[model samples]
Target: MRHTVTMSPDSLWGLPQIRAVCLMAFAGISSFAVMLAALPVWGVGHAVPAHLAGTITTVMLAATVLTQVVSPALMRRFSLRGLLVWGLVLLGLPAPLYLWATALPGLYAVSAVRGVGFGLLTVTAALAIQVAAPPGRQGEAIGLFGLAGAIPTMIGAAIGAGLTLSGNFGWVCVIAATPLLGLAAARGVTADGTAPGGAGESLPMRIALRRLVVPVVLLFAATAAGGAVITVVPLELTGSARAALVLLVFGAVTAYARWRIGRFTDRRGHRLVPQTLTVIGAAGMAVAGWGFAAASVPLLLAGAIGTGIAYGALQSVTLDLAFSRVPAGQAPIASATWNAFFDAGTATGAAVFAAVAAGSAGGAGSMLVGTGLFLLVGLATVRSALAPWLERRRGPGRMEP
Candidate 1:
């Protein structure tokens, strides 16, 4: 197996394919992220009902999740290169159409199409990472890819929202078309989606999904917390500049932590990683929420740093663990499933957080506090109760519990 062969740490990055995937992933995700923040603002500015403003994002995410769920089946019919190139086209070519699609129906239609492209782009790119990275260095390679993805999302949102609010929707659309530039990168990646050996083909999808459920849930919760913080902070802060600064801090911390955690887990293993990060996330959420409520900049910034680190590390740790639990042949399925849950978690968090902010007097702050507490309780239940229950459920002949 390629993973069994030793390679230099830097060799993974040296591969032309790895660099291509990273650049394509960055450009593709940046396209999605920029518009994700802009569309809602555009809706609100265009006099879409306040209650329905967030539906723009929800609809797009719904399309994305649905596409991801069925991507494995799609992969059977399409090459990864075909998917990547077409996905970029589908995601990018529609940017200018937004100019004409100013109403709710038009916006949703365009978003849904772009969302499908996003779904195609994300799943294919993730699988490409598995295919492109050196066997032994998959963890670090995935981390680097995560860092590529994380940066654009954080900065893209800030830029998109800032630009849209300042009456530069046209510029936002132009920037959102960044995926168009990635077409060249897309062409450089491996076209085949087949796993190295056919061994993983024997593993049932049900079994692969069952083993992955724990990590998927963990990822979902962490993303929810992170998404809530990212979506709500701007609304709660009095000024755009402060909100942008907080977001920048959060993104920077997350990008760096994800990259480092990949290397750390590659060496030390991942048993304690998720639990520890969850605790950090809980505390970060509480502090940030309190800071928001009290209007303290320092506490808010501090909380963002902690939350970013926890969220970013968890992203790396959980993904590595998920891939570890599955056989190599089943990687595409794993990637699709993980990406689906990741998007679903973010969408759910954004919607739920926005609702709480709209309805509650304490608003986003209280929701953050409650989310933090929820994480703590969830951690306790998983460690004290769920782990043992799962252990007892595993049969003696089955793979290690």
Candidate 2:
């Protein structure tokens, strides 16, 4: 059996493929961040029913899932650069539609189009990172890829929210511009000489199911915490500025944590990262819960920072673990499957938390309970699942490279 060799850190960083991966991350994540920021504004400007706002987000997520199912096949047919550029174009062209969207159906259609574009961007970017990364460094590579969005998400959300506060939809156009920039970045990425592998083999539904269950459950719990924040927190708070500040702080802290953890995972391993993060996350949730209960602004901000860090690292770690178990050729599918869990978690979290908040469990009570769940069952299970994998990576005969 011929083993593939891993690249040294220096070589990995020098590769154009790696640079491409970072660019795609920046572009893809920024686009989504802008959309998230603009959605609430569009909802209010158009008199969108409050109850239906969640549904709009659901539409985009649903479309993303549907498109992701076929993304691997699409990559097989097109070069990464081709897929990325087209995806960016698709993502960019749809924002103007928001200006004319007068009804729920139109808004949902816009979201669906953007979602499809996002789906394409995500899968291609995942594949790009896999091809670019050194063996044994997949965790770090993916973590860095995640930072692309994390940074832009923090910046774009702040800008979008600021523009929305001005009661202007023109900022949506500005947000769309980032995707075009991404298109230019995508063009610079040379297609790796390697062709797509595992062209015709379908991912067994049973196996994908078995592999995904635990990770999905944990991710769902965490995202539910996010959903509660995105949905219930804004509505419950008296001012949009304060609410936006909360979200901004959350994004910033999360991005920083992800960067640190990615570098840590590259050197240390995935297990320790998650274990440490989970403990910290648990404490953060406790603080957040306390803050919510007491309505303390300082405590709330601190909690948001902690939760953001944990959440950002969680997704990247999960993706690294999934890829570690799968063949290199199957990394894209593994990533897509992993992301599906994330999307499901987001949806489930939003739905469950919304119910709690609506039920007279005030927003504070709902957040406390939801975040508390993350600290307890969610973080605990994630740490437990990662233990065996960590042990294997450390064993004498099972060196990471």
Candidate 3:
């Protein structure tokens, strides 16, 4: 059998396909980050109910999931650039809608439209690099791709959301829309969704999904906590200015950890990575909840820093492990599955916490609940990661756990 050689993480940057993926991922993620920070404020400011406000994200992310499930077929039908252009259009054109979208249904409509665009951009951009990378280097290549996209989001989320805290939704939308417009104008990327090895004779989606469950669920839990923070922490923190900083800390730490920990995963293999991430996540959640309950900004900031690191590491490591579990030619399936778990987890977390926030202790109770969930999930993932290692120690002939 012929084998494809892997590119070292540093060497991988030289490839056009990977570069294009990074460029697009940066544009897409930055756009989403700004809007994500701004829109919930917009909804609540205009007197939309908190529960209804949360549903906006739910609809948007749900739309993302719906689009991603069918995205592989869409990629085959259109040029990757063509699809990306549309995704950018969908992402950008609706910016001004937020200005006029006062009614609940109108806001949800705009969010849903934007969500489809995000779904397309994310699915295509992420898988593009996965297909582009050579063998063995898949984990590093994806990690770097994630790192490149995250830096802009870290900076932009703080600045954009900080401005939005003062009711500057219009400019945030403008900022969100501008980059994609420039990219589309440049027309630098013009390619279709062609895969290496032809990705020949695709496996049925149902079977592929079944193979992806374990990694996907762990991802779901981690993202659930992250989604909780993104959705609630901003609204619940002492004030929007300070609250915005919490988001800043979250994004900054997340970006740094993804960059640093990813290379470690590539070099060391995935052995303890997932379990370690869960532990870090649980600790962060515990501290964050403690801060929330006590109304301590310092502890809150520290918690955000810790959770941010875990969130970043969780994202890169989980996806890296997901790819490891799949067949070489099934990059699209892996991308779709990874994306779904993330979006779905985010939507679920947001809605769940939003429901709880309307209660007596405000969002502090929600934070405590989130801490418990993280601890349980961390323990569960550690056990899952060790099960196979324990089995190996017992010998290959052993089947029972």
Candidate 4:
């Protein structure tokens, strides 16, 4: 039935609905990246305690993660569109607060609210793409959507950081809030684009949860490593420029891999793709660990590229598979589940890696542990989702074909 739904031949960027959602997503993410990048720098420059300066991000991310976990359940009684609208309001209205003389507590509160907005914006738009995309073109649509986030990540951080580093904090807030204005335009799109059932009222909680175990676990392992890398890599590198380069490379590669995953999946289907990427990720972890131990820049660069490839591929495959496992009506629940694992794993990974690496030989040991986690989860994913498909590799790759 879903395959029968008509869509433009271009699949990704052709339809009006997709274009609107992508445009809004690009702006929303840009707002987040630019402001998020600037805020801590501004705080640290103003002589705020390092711990306090850092808490801004930690608090916001935690809040965002929490919302991702809870919002889908609330959809039983509320409309997804309504929630998204409120979320946008929360996200956008708080931007100007940065220019004010708010106390630490006040700032923290604002950050929390904005985090909720970001969470809603992210999950809603993701599901919308799946719901509205043309038949046989979901992967391509997601890949195009990935561009919205990727572009901002590549440049927003630099602009935000450069601005705040130069003591132009006021402009950071203004710029950060500007993209959110696009939300108003997005509101004119259809509200009834999705079916209902994200909250588990339509399906038993146990069943819904059990169906998600494979993707959730895989995402958890992958994102855990991702979080650790983001948190520790910069600290391990010798210079700020080197650290920036590593992150930039990681982000660019990740975005490209995400875009490519869709195209690959459209042609190949998911079958062994996630497993393959996980193996590559494990090797990348090995490279990263070795680089950390030897302090080798080239190894680090290679590791970032490899790890990013796996990260993006895994992310796309898991979420896409999650939606495929259930009815279209339940996409929101799947989205929430996928995001919860992603957010929780990231936070947990950073903390655990920091703890273990601090007392061990060096970052290398922690990275090796990351590799171990990926191997474990990758095997689980194969057994759970790909085992039957794996047997069909003797033929053409697609399960249908």
Candidate 5:
């Protein structure tokens, strides 16, 4: 027997558990978003080498990935509320430390510590959703969850970038402290002592990894592209409000697409959507690359909008797919694995794009253009290679599940 949550959208939104998780997610993600653009820009301003500054993100996300990998074990050893509380503490307490750690190595150290906290938040937050949501409503629940995360990105990235550029670092620290407010909501989360999927019915980690390659690849590619944009554009377009605007539009569009696509996928299914989004994202990267290389604000804004839609939609879809492919009890495994890919891809993009900008004459814009071409070619190759195998597996005319 399985549990089913059959409720209207309003009713679902009204659930105490849902409200608690959303508030917590909003606070945690806001802390992350505020620092995402600000830290790199701050590093560049304080005598850090341009190329090395991007590594701030790389270091943070590297820690995030490592923490996510070990989160399953952590969840088993601790209370969910305890972990969530500590994650918020670690994430918030370190922001003010940035004021003292002006050196590159010190900054990286702070980022790495913060990343650990973020890692705990990412997996635990998703697990909270898994436990709170009713059967058959996972997509909508994820959409709402995504919506909470997106608003902060939209508001925080632009604000952080803009503020840091204006030389207002203390304010950035203040905004980064927002995660502390989530402590109240964390207590209300419906956490039991057991890890999700601890029962014998769950699949082994190795098998789950094998079953999840498709969504993981799609998620990795999309996040890599988006992360490159977020990491490099601030450095490339310094001293101009245009950079902030570009980030603003990207965040706004991403929020709407991620939230809406959840319901759409629930009704229409997931078959063609991921491929279509990849195409759109690849194209957006190309346009934005041209915009960056050319320093055209309009083109940058246009590119941001296109990529934002694809990035947000792919996030929701990949997550929903990850949940759907696993045993119901195995949600924590899926959440941790998916989040690890998410941060790993972002870190890879930040490092690779920053290196490309440093090495290439055409800089960030050129890197974006090349990345777009790479994604396009990769997608086409993957489809060509997979179609034959799929046809043989499911018969010539069957739709993919």
Candidate 6:
């Protein structure tokens, strides 16, 4: 007989396991928020050159990618609760260090320390959620889990921007404290050793690579578009207020779309929803770029919303696709690998788009290039290149169990 796991709404609140997952999610995500909040402030405060800001971001993302590779092994050795709490402390306590970071060396040190913490927190939280979630509802649980990070990305950027406007270094410290809130939440929850059952068993790297290709490619495309906008939009607008508004709109739409897409994927499958969103996103980027070139505020806003929606949908859907194909025990590794792709895409997008926009043709030319890439990704999905391969590997008629 198959086991049936039912989780009540109130049960989620009362159960230590469920509560633990929520806490970790909140803590991990808040750490991410602090990082986003810190970047621009650090860039301006130290009078770092604009060309260097992208490199700084790349260093942090590179750290994340490296750490994510080893996260599964780390989780296997340490309890989830232990890893999360320690990671939170490492993430939170580094704020004071940032206050002292007046030089590039100091900033680099801070990035390395914080990057490790963020990387561990991300992987641990996802593992906790997957283990805590009752079977058959993993998709919804992961979706909700994702919001801890998504919501903050929107809020943190705005708050970070606001704090910067105050012309105070103290606000950066305050923002750094934000991750502690998650630590408090994590303290109330318990760790489960059984969460990652059978995870340490060796698997072929080739198999893992083949399974991850589709989601990684999709991630690359989405982040490239997002990266292009993030790099070029501000320069094109030439007004802090307008640039901030664009980011704010992008964050809000992305957050809502993430929540809705989670449920949609849980009911449907990952393949179709994301493919459709990619096409829409390409169009949105095209419109937004055109608007940026024409200086049309309304068109820019429309494009921002579309891009946000598409990003939100794609983020969760890609994770779902990975988890659906792998063993339940491998969720953490799967989640980490997926995030590494996201970070890589973001890093590449920032660097490449900035270079492209620096040319005589400017931001408009860069957007056009980004739009073409997104559309190509969309076409690949429509051709069923990834879906059929994944379906065949798992065999027919096997849905998430």
- Candidate 1 off by > 4 Å: 1-7, 193-201, 373-401
Q: Which residue pairs clash in candidate 6?
A: none
TM-score of candidate 1 to 2 decimals: 0.90
How do the residues 1-401 of candidate 3 rate in per-residue lDDT, one tens digit apiece? 01234445367778777777687678777877777656776788889887766788888999999999988677767777777777877887786787898788998998899999989888877777677767777667777887876776686667666777787777887777854653643254556455333445555767667667767776787777777777777778647788788888888888877767666765666665666777777778778878888888888888888778778887877777666665666766787789999899888877787667656756677766767776677676676566666878787632111
Ranked candidates (lDDT, high to low): 5, 1, 3, 4, 6, 2
Cα lDDT tens digits, model 1, 358-392, are 56544445447545654764575355323434566
Local lDDT at 88 for model 3 = 79
| Reference-based TM-score of each model | 0.90, 0.85, 0.90, 0.82, 0.92, 0.86
Question: Poorest 10 consecutive residues of model 1 by lDDT?
Answer: 1-10
The TM-score between candidate 4 and the true structure equals 0.82
**Ten residues in sequence with the least summed lDDT for candidate 4:** 1-10
Per-residue alpha-carbon lDDT of model 4 for 262-333, expressed as tens digits? 766876676667778889999988998998999888898899888888877777777777777666667778
Error of 4 at 88 (Å): 2.8
Question: Local error of candidate 2 at 278, Å?
Answer: 3.7
lDDT of each: 0.75, 0.67, 0.74, 0.71, 0.80, 0.69
Q: Judged by lDDT, which candidate is best? A: 5
In TM-score terms, candidate 6 sits at 0.86
| CA RMSD (A), model 6 | 3.8
Model 2 local distance difference test score: 0.67
Best by TM-score: 5
Residues 1-401 of candidate 2: C-alpha lDDT, one tens digit per residue: 01334436474456677777688668766877766646755675688765555566677877877888887677767788887777787777787777787588888898889888877777777778877777666766777777776888777665665566566667656676577776656655776433357755545657655665555555566666665565555544556677678778988887876666655665656444555566666666667667767877788789787778777887677666666655556666776777666666666555556556556666666666765676665545654655566776787333221
Candidate 1, residue 212: how far the Cα is off, in Å? 0.7
Regions of model 4 farther than 4 Å from truth: 1-8, 34-56, 76-79, 95-108, 157-175, 198-202, 354-362, 389-401
Greater lDDT among 2 and 3 belongs to 3
**Candidate 5 whole-model C-alpha lDDT, 0 to 1:** 0.80
lDDT of 5 by residue, 208-292 (tens): 8866777877888878877777877787886648778989999999999989997777766676678788878877877887787
Instruction: Tell me the lDDT of candidate 1.
Output: 0.75
Clashing pairs in 1: none
